[model samples]
Target: MIRKLEGRTWKFGDNINTDLMIPSFALAEPEEKQPKYCFSANRPGWVDLVKPGDILVAGNNFGTGSSRPGAKVLKSLGIICLLAESINGLFLRNCVNYGLPALPCPGVFSSFNEGDIASVQLEEGKVVNLNSGRVLATTALPNMLLEILAAGGIVPLLEGKGLLDKAR
Candidate 1:
């Protein structure tokens, strides 16, 4: 994973949960077909608007529901990373596990609007709004977690070390 990421923003509000991201009904679909149903419950046509390398900027309690592999679906939708006022613990872990860089950035939600550009420096824990020239500090991920993300999540890291059977 690149330590620095820059992309267009897609703003969402507080308490945006896992169900809103990938509804239970969509779970039955094949993985490749699942991205189309993302945000179907609320933002009905949101999936169609997302472009590859877009960044999701959301308000507090982002990803506040079940452990439903929501990060994977977001990544599939071409979201490069997530920047939120706060992120749920389990969801943060899931993002790392799925190779998505999610930062808990205080004041981020107010700094950028939809379609604004955001630049994130992961290692430095800094978020800058390119459009408005605003900058916010984020809670940085530890180096160990960064390594996991860089290696494309824990499973791949272990596989590369021959610690687990790759065929599985």
Candidate 2:
């Protein structure tokens, strides 16, 4: 089962490009420092403040910008998945490959402006609009990817079943 994430919320505006998601400049740093710098623009302190299992709600075009790996670098900071009106094709694909969860959720923004607690069911593929008493949208997770997300990102998933050593 996918580990559902639920807790206090944090919000973001529309067209949150990849640069803000994970600034290109941060790629120059070590991998250990990479995930820490995600979302440096729309919410500067968010990368540090977002606790594990906190739900995130964003406005339309949540990821609309250049195709960069930076946007897919936040599994460590604990952004369980993205709930927004729409997402760019490039960003969406990048997130999926990297084991990040990006769901298309149009009405999520209207339900709670931000800072409101919300519940996320990664397997049932739904985000509960807690305040509005509605389920906003379904997640776009493939079966394999759902397992990776359930195990807390890709590396943990691979280590769990011991498939990583096949190449060795």
User: Which structure among the candidates has the greatest lDDT?
Assistant: 1
lDDT of 1 at 156: 90
User: TM-score of predicted model 2?
Assistant: 0.76
lDDT of 2 by residue, 1-168 (tens): 756667677777788887786678876888778777787665677777887766567787766777767445655676667777777777766666667776776677777757777777766667886666677666556787666655656666677878787666
Q: Per-residue lDDT for 14-98 in model 1, tens only?
A: 9999998888888888878877888898788899999999999999999999999999999999999999989999999999999
RMSD of 1: 1.2
Q: Lowest-scoring 10 consecutive residues by lDDT in candidate 2?
A: 70-79
